[model samples]
Target: MYTDSATYNALLDGFCKCGQIDEAFMLFKSFRDDGFKVGIRGFSCMIDGLIRSKRIGEAEKLFQKVFDVGLVPDLILYSIMIRGLSESRRLEDATNMFRDMIGKGIVPDTQCYNMLIKGFCDVGLLDEARSLKLEISQHDQFPNTCTYTILICGLCRNGLLGEAQQIFNDMEKLGCSPSAVTFNALIDGLCKDGKLEEAHLMLYKMEIGKNPSLFLRLSQSADPILDSASLQKMVENFVDSGLILKAYKLLMQLADSGVVPNINTYNTLINGMCRAGQVNRALRLSEELQLKGHFPDSVTYSTLIEGLQRVDREGDAYKLFEQMTENGCKPNSSVYKTLLSWSCRRRKTTVAFGIWLKYLRSLAGHDGEALKLTEEFFQKGDMEKALRSLLEMESKLADFDSAPYSIWLVGLCQADRVEEALKTFSILEEFNVVVSAPGCVKLIHALCSGGKLDKAVDIFLYTMEKGYRLMPRVCNSVLQVLLDSKDNTILAFELLDKMKSMGYDLNSYLHRRTKSLLQHHYSLRKMENVAAR
Candidate 1:
């Protein structure tokens, strides 16, 4: 093979294109050593290969050598140098090189402009990136899909979601169809911002391939642009945001679009529906999912069972638990805990005991240690020791859930250990355990009965602050205790006003009693004033 300068340049170009940078570099060095004058074309190939290999310093030296060799760099060489510098995060150097390219009468194309914009965006210089995007149009070059997508992605990453959305809308108006990457970035931003409805609508548009105008009307619009998305994640966001109905509707749309949701998605919807007090709707959804061949997993069963129990449908919950076992979906520790906690709260002693037995049977030997300590402490009437042992076992075994701690708090309150119960409640709170509403109410009432009026008021206020719904009787009892005390009448009135702000209605008896007490207090004050006069 009689290799000449042209043949050497061809080999270099081929090696660089194929990512054989070392081979390309060695061939270039050998060609130079053989006294073959390397043309600007050969230098461009070598520089591009060095840049691709992340050897920016070496590439810059080669680029400088082109000027020393008295060869004015062409647009191809300048473009390669600018792209290399921009990608290496040397934005200033890239910008200077870009200006130099123009100074030498070499006009840049849209691709060159896009490279600079991406560099700006990569470093969160969104304002600069946006400016470069505008510059593209001024240079008689329209911003392409790549350009807009880069800017949108950068804006979204910087939490400028509103601007990102506007850019997306503009991209659509200009007839640039958004790619999957663009949609994913925008959807993810919306989800993170808690804009569940917007995220859902955007995801629907992406999956269904509807045009902007038609999507606004949600009718038959543009051609279908089918793209894959994190549909389950969007459902989760909807559920987490308390948009249960919206999540349900999203699920329906997903199904209509021939996108099959997994059982996890159904389970999330069921949990959200149950929490929103739409237990009946949740059950219907369960049936719908089952019909669609998405059988309920243990999570689905546990969520529905808890939802049923929440609505006071204990029999339905029990039946579902049996169905879960029959379906071969072994109820997990969570399911057993749910049954045990609810049974104990409802004072179904036999049911709770049975559930506890089943829970123990379901666990391996060591996993049941904390529960056994709970049982032993309860049997010996040692609530403190029981709680202590449970905590110790939890630190060692890490198998105890919030259920056993809640049961102990309720039991302590029921046993009239109000002080101990309060301390236990505080410990539970420190551990981020949510005590049941019934347990809170019982503790509050017990505190009132024990002549701990201030403590009782504090507990009541704490529960109210946490958004726990208590019976009117609890409020009335606290108000009665406050009004009965000479020093706490003002507190009673303040509590009444606070309750009003919280949307609680005072019963007629308390209202009348408050009025009578105020009048009586005024009458006594008037008698004292007369005596002083």
Candidate 2:
């Protein structure tokens, strides 16, 4: 019953316009099977569909098929193909297509010229696009609202807001009112440029103008490429500037406007409230986001846990931690680390060990638990228990390393346990991780404090041989230790000279005091010699 080529072409065009490219192709194959030839319009329709769906490669292949079919495409087909190529940002190809059409004596209409001009402008070829526009106007043909909209959007996207505004004014002078598509594009551009006040003013104008048409325009335009992103930046500025009510009003507006708030938007608002120490407000926002179909993800819970822990709200933090897990969110290793760090800071050794055991048992029975517990004990200043914890778990944790072992060694050296400290050092060397600079410096200071200068010298020499850079604080602590011993006073100055050569600026007062003490001791010896004479 479908006997005409134009009828089938119309049907194919309808399919392609509705995004049914595959179905359109199927009908084309049926036409070929029935010995009915296809025209350039049907083929161009399929190409348009491919381009709309971002299948540029397939569109190109179909473009070549049109030529292979031995039918010269008309201006309509060329326009559709140019629109596809331009929208895909194939500016050069779109230009070539236009030139090819012109060479074939097919003069471009408004649609063809607009498509290529927009392509050139979108890619920042403003001069070329302007030249094309001027040529079209010289021919007594005027550009449409869509043509001005494209140029304005291109200018705005390229951050030429001033130029974009001029074009916008020109559009208004031409009595061409901006559609919702045009307004949305400008709003997005303004928001990205941080022109929030302007965006707000535009939104206000749209609302008060009773233009339900604009709302429909925005809703029906291509799904927004901007939503909730500007909400985050606005919330941050409002919080920093103490505009809490403004932030709250913006959030409500976004909700009413059907803009989906992203995770970053929720986090920004919640964390800003917490940073302001408005914990109650922060907690309420967390509940609000969750109730609005966005569950607090890992980052959200972690931020709340950290904020509560920082303010000594451990009971509240623990309750939230448990609730997070009950809500089907698994607590990560970072959560356990935060709790352990909090316990250590509060000097709750028992609580720290309990958390460590819980973390280990959760992963069955692993020796990592022992290493973590030993570090906790050392951090809480329980060296004996720390060393004991490591030793008891040594066989199971054979491959484990603990900072507590080095911490215990320093404690032993402070207790005058020379042989025990040496044994600890030997155990450390066997583990293949050399003593850290802080560990070595702590051990040297402990030895010097206990009047064991020889052992301290040996440890310092060993540290140098290992190539560890001594911190200025550690160097100062060591020199103070030597000053107490009153034996290595000369060596301390030699160390100071070395530190200076290594670019460390020792305190002028401390250096002068050390020199004065040395001079006084030399004068005492001279006085003793003179008295004997």
- Candidate with best lDDT: 1
**Which residue runs of candidate 1 sit more than 4 Å off their true CA positions?**
1-258, 268-281, 284-291, 325-337, 349-374, 377-388, 395-404, 407-441, 446-479, 485-519, 522-533
lDDT (10s digit) by residue, model 2, range 122-220: 789988887887777654678878877888788888888888778776887887777666777788888999999998987776667553454355446
Candidate 1 residue-wise lDDT, 1-533, digit = tens: 34677887889986764445665776777566445789999999989877765689999999999989888899899999999999999999999999989888888888899899989999999888988888887767888899999998899999999999998998878989998779999999999999999999999989778433532332232423132235677778888887988888767765655557888888888988877657788899999997888888889899988777655567889899999999999998778877876775665544555566556556675546667767777577675665566565564555556666667567566667678888988877665667777777778788878887777777777777889767655676677777889877777777777777777755542445555776787688789899999
Per-residue error for 423 in candidate 1, Å, reads 9.3
Measured over all alpha carbons after superposition, the RMSD of each candidate to the real structure, in angstroms, is 29.4, 27.4
Q: Can you give the lDDT of residue 168 in candidate 2? A: 73
- Whole-model Cα lDDT per candidate? 0.77, 0.70
| Strongest candidate by TM-score | 2
Q: What is the TM-score of candidate 1? A: 0.40
